[model samples]
Target: MTSLDIAFLATGAITVAAALLAVTTRHLVHSALWLVLALGGLAGCYLVLGAELVALVQVLVYVGAVVVLVIFAMMLTRAPIGPSPDHSTSRLHRLLAAVLGAGVTALLLAVLLPLGGEVVARTPVSTTGIAEDIFGTWVWPFEALSLLLLIALIGAFAVSRLTRPAGEVRR
Candidate 1:
């Protein structure tokens, strides 16, 4: 097999292993670290697929900002850093989840494999076109996302303030 095929296989394996670890790890911090590895593997896959912009954004936005925020929130809330509380689901629930996941996977494979052959023939649009479409047709959603970020920032600030010692009142 080609080097590219080998690299893809290796990355895919790492991604799956990291994902499994993230779900199965009892320690909250260890789970988050495994999640970071899984996300990094995804970025590597994006790079392999020749989507450098997507890869960079995935690393920056997901690994950098979102994960950091999650870690900070965990610290702020004084969540137990030790093993998580035992919260095993019933066997029936596990069976249902497995069946649902299998159905979704089969459906996606059926739909996507047929469409994949057509994607190679299409000419890629310029980055500017993507920007214009987002700023023009999707302006409202873009603005809403910005507003959501603002609200999150305000909420974080409010929560941190509330958690502070009562004797240290803000001016």
Candidate 2:
């Protein structure tokens, strides 16, 4: 009906299509790449909703960090890059995922929609204040998370090194 509505619809469509492709693709690497597209589209949708900080976090955290971590994990585990020998997700897993997704959808609708189905107005949030709060009060937790990630990296390296060929020297 309007330009903003059209933009939202377009972003939502891209997100759905990319998410479907991500799940359905046979190739592992291609699935990860498609996931990036899906994540980016969701971030775009967040941007269209005026949630700039959320969009940025979605792109930076999910696409940049999580997806990269997954890709690296796949490489580290020596997962097949081409078409998987078997489906990426088993039939039972897919069925469970569908059920979980549907349940979440129902829960959200129940919570967000009013008894009369009237829309609720929301006030826009300021990104500057959020950034200030994150950098100031929440800095310690952020640093702690960084330390935890470092420990995880060290553990991964240890595991990989231990699993290397017997003749190979420890790194």
Candidate 3:
């Protein structure tokens, strides 16, 4: 195939491998780090596909904002950095989760495969158009999402502050 196809395949493989590692890892912080790698690999795929704006957004939103927020929340809640026996699932649970994930993936493929042949003739969307659509039409929803994230950060901080030692005096 072409160079772009090869590049995309490489990036996709990296993304999939990183995602699998992220899910399977026992260490909490390591999982988040793997998630960052997966997201960055996804951005690389977007870049290979010539979606620079989408790649930028993927990096900024998912890698920079979401993963950082997740790490912060984890730290704030005092989540275990290393492996915890309490978080381990039984073999049956793991098997069932894998089966469910595969079933959903198959279902999605079955539904979407039929639409693959219906190619619509349309002009390529420009970065400016997308920016306008996001900043102009979808600004309110974006702002609301930001507010929700801010509230979550505040909640995490509040929860963390409430778990002080018995001997510690309140301010």
Candidate 4:
């Protein structure tokens, strides 16, 4: 096999292992760290596929911003830095998750392998054209995403404020 094939296989394995660890780990911090590894693996996959912008955004948005925010929230809440109290998943939930994941994988393969008809091939469009298309045709979704981020920020502030200790409450 080619080097690209080998790299893809390795990254895929790392992603899966990290995802499993993220789900199964008893400690929340460890789970978040595992998620970082998973996101890193995804970024590597994007790089392999020649999507430098996507890879950079994946690393910056997921690893740098989102995960850091999650860790900071954990610290702010004074959540248990050790293993979580509830690590056991019910059999039904486990089965449901497995079925959902398998179904999604099968659907993706079915749609992309042959039925999609060469959609994965790199297009010749320039980055400026792509940006223009997004800004022109997909402006609503972009604005909605910004609004969603604003709402999330507000919610985080509200949660932090509500969870403050009694004696530490600020006016």
Candidate 5:
């Protein structure tokens, strides 16, 4: 195998591992941190695949913006840092979830196994073309999404503040 292939594999492995940890961890902040690692690893995988723009977007949009927003929301809401017993599931629920996950994995493998032998040629994409497309055609949607996220952040802050007792006042 080539070095690029090895790098892709390594990054993919790291991404999967981090994603698993992000989901399975009981601590809220730790899960968000693991999500950052997962998203960063995904960006690395995109880089190894030679999609520099995609890699940058992955890093900027996911790892930089989304994960930061998650952490910020957590802090704004005063989320528990450590494990909470209230979030724990019973053994039966855990077992069912595992079984469902395995079944979905098997289904995906079954669907993708037929395409394993086929190699599709990739066309080179220019960074400028992508940038123009994003900024020109999709600019409004992108700006709208950003505005939506900002609104959501503000809403979270408002809700968190409203949760205080009647006698409590902001300093």
Candidate 6:
């Protein structure tokens, strides 16, 4: 196998593991950090697929903006840091999880095995075209993202103000 294939598989495995950990972790902040790792791995996958624009956008939009907003929101909401014992799973739950995981694996194999690992040709997409599409057609989503960032900043301000000691005067 080519080095790119090895890198892609390694990155995909990291992405999947991080994503699973992000959901299963008992600590809130740790979940967000793991989500960042997962998103970074996704960007690496995009890079390996020869889609530089997509990789850049995945890193910038997801890791830079979305993850930062999530972290800020967690901080603003005073999310728990340490693991919570209550988050522990029961044996029944573990069994159910294993079943679900195996089912998913079976489904993926059933789908992909039929294709015989065929490589589909993808049209080379230009950055200029992507930029135009994002800015022109999907302008509302861009604006919404900016709004979300603004809201996160405002929430951070409000949270800081609330946590301030009562004796401290606002500047």
lDDT of each: 0.77, 0.83, 0.91, 0.80, 0.89, 0.87
Model 6 lDDT-worst window of ten: 78-87
Candidate 6: residue 138 lDDT (0-100) = 91
lDDT of 1 by residue, 1-171 (tens): 888888888888999999989876778888889999999999988777666666786898679866776677677655578864454566798799878888999999999999877746657766577557766897898678557756775666567656567688543
Of 1 and 2, the candidate ahead on TM-score is 2
Best TM-score goes to which candidate?
5
Rank the candidate models, highest TM-score first: 5, 3, 6, 2, 1, 4
Tens digits of per-residue lDDT for model 3 on 1-171?
Answer: 999899999999999999999999999999999999999999999899777888998899889988988999999988878988888999999999999999999999999999999988978888898788888998999888788888988898888878667899643
Distance from true location, Cα of 42 in model 6, Å = 0.6
Number of colliding residue pairs in each model:
0, 0, 0, 0, 0, 0
**Which scores better on TM-score, 1 or 6?**
6
Tens-place lDDT digits, model 6, residues 135-156 = 8999998899889788877977
Question: Candidate 1: misplaced stretches above 4 Å?
Answer: 86-88, 115-119, 122-150, 153-157, 160-171
147, model 4: CA deviation in Å? 4.6
What candidate 4 gets wrong by more than 4 Å, as runs, is 86-88, 103-122, 131-147, 163-171
Off by over 4 Å in 5: 166-171
Instruction: Tell me the tens digit of each residue's lDDT in model 5 across 1-171.
Output: 999999999999999999999999999999999999999999999889888998998888878888888888998887778987777899999899999999999999999999998999978889898899988999999899789889879977987886667899644
Question: TM-scores for all candidates?
Answer: 0.71, 0.72, 0.88, 0.70, 0.89, 0.74
Of candidate 2, the 10-residue stretch with the lowest lDDT total is: 155-164
Ranking by lDDT: 3, 5, 6, 2, 4, 1
